[model samples]
Target chain A: MSQLFQHLEPSDSHFEPDKDEVLNAIRWNADGLIPAIAQQYDSGEVLMMAWMNREALEKTLQSHRVCYWSRSRSTLWRKGESSGQVQKLKAMNLDCDGDTLLLQVDQEGPACHTGRRSCFYVRLEQNKAWVDQAPLIDPKTLYTNKP
Target chain B: MSQLFQHLEPSDSHFEPDKDEVLNAIRWNADGLIPAIAQQYDSGEVLMMAWMNREALEKTLQSHRVCYWSRSRSTLWRKGESSGQVQKLKAMNLDCDGDTLLLQVDQEGPACHTGRRSCFYVRLEQNKAWVDQAPLIDPKTLYTNKP
Candidate 1:
């Protein structure tokens, strides 16, 4: 992973950081995980937020695809591996605090398991109530006929 | 704080939640803080990310302004109170996992203390190096008088 991975090849803004060095800079939580926000590159829309461990981040950098640590399954979850809603990584950014991540990706299909374009379909209304904004796509249809 | 503050008052989308109920839903980290992502509502541009505790979240909801728990200062920090880079809260959302927050805000001026529109102005180049993509603003000018 020491080899340079050209994220923006053929461009003037080119620089390199060792893979291990980049990973070490992150201040992981007590759970050894960091929160990663996935945003649509072109639209600037926030698609979803997930958790990533060192292995997940390494895999994402290596594969050029979005990978997250599934706390439920305790496994490396590759985006769109099953649901066909893949996140093609465009670029990744670390916050100034180095405890969080921002992922700009070309997202395909819905980003939410509930079949919404974004996980933030619901918002707090004026009355302090939650209001559903985006339409939902049934997860059943999304997972139908697929193993 | 017990009374429902109309966030979207004089509108149709109005509802209310008890303060205790709202706080109880969040699963704060061991540090008694949760990660909060601030996104520009109209633009979908993520301006910055910060940490918020129960008090901060409550204050944001009650005041209709963004407040964060400053880890470095160990105090409740109100956005733009000093730098004039304020974040007006539009709405807030809790992820499905109840561990993180997505705050939709109307940001005024640069959100990054570094004077960038966002803290994520640096990108990982294909050469595996970090390249600055956004123009910098001097914090010295941003916080000139009255500390």
Candidate 2:
């Protein structure tokens, strides 16, 4: 356990849990990762979901930003390297058992790949039909010719 | 197990594992949910992460979309309902143990609340310095006076 992880319990109201405490407190699965939920700090809109390993968690804490582990290539991936949409970490919260994490970030751009502002752009009507709400951002403009 | 949950093998490549199979397959500690990673199907950008309970998992599968169990509100939530950034279900792949899920979604908007396309917007340089990559979108246009 690193000294950076030590902090107070978020539920205590008086106890402000630090990065280390939040990371170490969580019940990471055998894979050494935890589920992190990114939400709009003000509007309470969920942006997306990603995995966070110890190192990524630490980086997020130290930087006051959000970091996640990429399972596809099995590596540490920082957001916005190519797209430029960044998450500035404002506050981090842990679930009761420390199995999940909620990150309040200062987001920079759209949070989805389709060029919209969020990954969640579909809507289900009262009849249970799924409908597209908005047009996606043209990929060409978003990727900056990176392909 | 319901008929929907049957016929799902942890090793089946083509078949998207159902909620039961996903729960049974993963290495969940005591929590009923697993760590599911949401990514853009086309561009392969990482989005956000959230917990998937049995209901959320089933809902996502049934609707051919992404859903999650919100710990704070203790409810099953469909992505993009309020924000209009819906995750259209492209395909669902479970990790080896079924504890992790790779959701390839036709993302509509930004996956981050900060109006970025992906939740991963912050980047760390070689010197461990954090850098912001993604830009923020105008929320007024996105929400469009939907109070």
Candidate 3:
């Protein structure tokens, strides 16, 4: 494998470290959360970014689905639980300082609540933001009952 | 062009808007900064993530080079100014809610101060983070004058 491959193939040996040790390796901020960014696996388009607490990270490790710590809701937010725009985890990476996470995911549908394939739809051009891409689907059609 | 093409080709009509209006469209948080993620232009590998304030963002727009707000130093950190690891801006995009910015750049050298190709080098797998990459250059050699 190249020296820069971000994907980690499972270790050949049955070498499982202590779960706590694994979690402790991360340098969570004072708020006990880390910034986590999700990218579309094949296209490499960065879909969205959110925060992840230990529980959210653990859940993602177990379920192969992305979960984020919702600072606004003060709870764990599972990707696409209501909208069905789930993100299936292909790989998870910890940054060098352990303060950030990057997830390579197979996004089920539009990754943004606004129905864009990526949350980023506005291009910065001529000192302004230009709406370069239209929403793939209507935002109203995604959510059913959430207020 | 597909709806997912993140690369922003420069506009031809020269529709320039007020700089402050462009800046105000971004939802700066309480800290008056936005999370900026840089991705390798051709490879699609995310290089590094940093914070950018209005000045740093403005400087980048004017120079076509990447600059970041140094939270610790309290000044604009011109990337590669000392380390020679400059990032040439190729494209820039603002996220849906206008809270995040993504930069596609041609990285001249290792993006990490640690000399890795990217700041993200540890892959979370089999319940832990595995160092999946090696530093491309010696960190010590990159800085000769900086303390």
Candidate 4:
């Protein structure tokens, strides 16, 4: 049996996602969203967690730049749109149930809005949420508007 | 200036998270839920992503067994309760924004219900979701009940 689990169509080397397959592949939540996690391609370090809609997934797949849905703002959030910290999508994976997404990304800059390399800076150690890393750049410089 | 971000109370050597901090620290969504990602402590492989409520968080912190809120069943899901694959919590991190959670776990067995090592077996390569890893055990044997 071929190792290929689910193939859209024969593409010699390039990714050519079928539009219908893309939409039907995932099991979207009640709100038509799925939880997406960004992991560093080289380091395997999880950079951040966010939500994505079908449109965001399509945009990311097409442009190869990660985009997410800003639930609070009720709009599409292009990663690093204002801060220039764009993440280049290396690979994407869907969990078995298809309720989650894992994106291997080549992050341009710090992933956290707080200027940390990863958003997971608050380590639960010794009963305290210790700030594990210091800011790489001033957070003020990262965001243009209050997000 | 102290590097300590947010401290619950003093626990010299062990993690003693404050109950108040546990509940108040997180910015729960309108539905009072947060997205949680589980990663293997040693490999840094993201095993799975799930939802967590205040009660789930409290249970995980207190018991260190890693429980999730089952949105589908509308009940608490104890990791490996049905299957023998319990995850031991090594560490927990709250992102700077406190909206998401990262769980470093010592997974006892396959993290996926499909009996695969990780839920993220459906890799998007060449525009198709190829099953990178095969199931170590039969999935039918893993699930005792319809979940």
Candidate 5:
């Protein structure tokens, strides 16, 4: 137990080292959070990036589903609760300094609020023009209650 | 053209006034980027979050596919070009602040590196145990030949 404390810096009071020390071993920004990138486990398509405070990080590790700190609401949110496009966690990884996280998951439906499969549908054209593509699934079908 | 300069601030050099004005009109953080979430257009699964510099933001908007700044590499990256789980743009929206963006996309396949459909597959059970729900797809089926 004492050995675990050795690798941890004093500023890391929020993190409790465990077997998967690498996950808990990274340095977080002053906000006590790190940027986590969620991607498709098989296809390797990047879905989104969110901040994870220590609590959220632990919750993610404990729950296996990804939880993130919503900067807008300043609260912890479980991905896909309202949309039903839940991300089933497959693995979690940390970058070299432990500032970033990669989450691999199993997705059920569109992840973006716009009702598309992913949130990255937009792109820049050769002439620097903005264009929108066809939607795969209508958001109205998923969230009938909300607009 | 001078009228456009009226809204320009000293810090706006890195961003185009037209784009910045629009992005700022929508809502952005001090960093001049919005929190855009990426989801699987097909599965409706949430994938990851990435910061969009003005250039990347404009690129995504113009192209109708997702483009983001890779903080890790500090470079521009387009989805699906490497892994093949490309995200085709469907739609885009700005949050109340004009800083946050919501993108709707058509995801081709797995959006995660671990071969899962999404990035939030792991969840902690009530008993404080790590649980993995989904299985991974074979990489061979996803990539015919490495690109």
Candidate 6:
């Protein structure tokens, strides 16, 4: 794996993501994307999971905000930009395979578009039935003009 | 969003994932895969994140073992089967958009192949340096024999 390692070049962003040693350790998929999971910094509750391309990762490291690559939209999405549910990055970690990232974030507002505190609002019941573990706030309340 | 809800037919799964109502809500990617994050049941530490196809998710819910779809090998991976780092599913959750899964597990041994308790061992320091938050245990010590 070390043989495949390549370093990130310096970026103009305020944070020096290029200087971050493990940046080169990320093993991106053929699509040049990796899964990024966000967990609440204090509670350890997982807020949401999204995909990040190399640029998205770099921007996140520089901005200290969660940035995701919107596959459907093919654009860089700064979380909470439209919904006001911003996630401030507290820390980031790379999994063993270097294909996954765990981001500890200071979450503001609900992390779900459905108005849930965390995106994981449904659970499988013992009877194999799925039930809501949390209540949904009106989506309209989260999005100002709908992004 | 609840108005758009529907139910699933009964299945033989102990938890009745078919009865698990949110099955249809999941919006799997074009590849028919979703990212699943595993967290320690007691400590709240995120262990690792992996990809799970429909079959992998079904089997995991049925058998109570964490099963992942290995993109590299294109096979179903039963965690810790060879290394004895098995993850017993304690609870499972689906994100609001149904694109991701959160699993709470009772993990045995290290959850990372690198012989670390959690896969998130690397952290970015203030000076943009990557630091090891945990010590790595020799991989050979974890595996009885190469699987």
Interface alpha-carbon RMSD, every candidate: 6.9, 12.4, 6.4, 6.8, 11.9, 8.4
> What is the C-alpha lDDT profile of model 3 across B10-129, one tens digit per residue?
222233434456566677767898989999989999988999998898888889989999877888899988887789898887776667899999998799877778887667765565
Q: What is the C-alpha lDDT profile of model 2 across A44-86, one tens digit per residue?
A: 5556667899899888877776779987769887776567777
Candidate 1 Cα lDDT to native: 0.72
* Per-prediction TM-score to the true structure, in the order listed: 0.81, 0.48, 0.84, 0.81, 0.49, 0.81
- Alpha carbon lDDT at B25, candidate 4: 59
> Whole-model lDDT for model 6 versus the true structure?
0.73
Clashing pairs in 3: none
Supply candidate 3's per-residue lDDT for A138.
73
Docking class of 2: incorrect
Docking class of 3: acceptable
lDDT tens digits by residue: candidate 5, B15-36: 3234344443544456665566
Per-residue lDDT of A23-92 in model 6, one digit per residue for the tens?
A: 6667887788998999999998888888999888888888898899988789999998898888999888
Can you write out model 2's per-residue Cα lDDT over B1-147, one digit (the tens) per residue?
223222321112223333333344445537787667676777665566677887787688788868888777788777876678788887665432235555778888776554656554333232332213333564445554332
Which of the predicted structures, 1 or 5, would earn the higher lDDT when compared with the native? Answer: 1
Candidate closest to the true structure, highest TM-score: 3
TM-score of chain B of each: 0.81, 0.75, 0.83, 0.81, 0.68, 0.81
Q: In model 4, where do residues sit more than 4 Å from their true spots? A: A1-19, A125-127, A143-147, B1-19, B144-147
lDDT of 1 by residue, A40-102 (tens): 999988878899998898788878899999988999899888888789998888765567789
Name the runs in model 2 displaced over 4 angstroms: A1-11, A16-22, A124-127, A145-147, B1-147
Over the true interface residues, superposed, what is the Cα RMSD of model 1? 6.9
Give the lowest summed-lDDT range of ten residues in model 4 chain A. A1-10
True contacts kept of 4: 0.43
Best by DockQ: 6
RMSD of 2: 13.2
What lDDT, from 0 to 1, does candidate 5 have? 0.57
Go through the candidates in order and give each one's C-alpha lDDT: 0.72, 0.58, 0.77, 0.77, 0.57, 0.73
Q: Clash totals for all models, in order? A: 10, 53, 0, 1, 76, 8
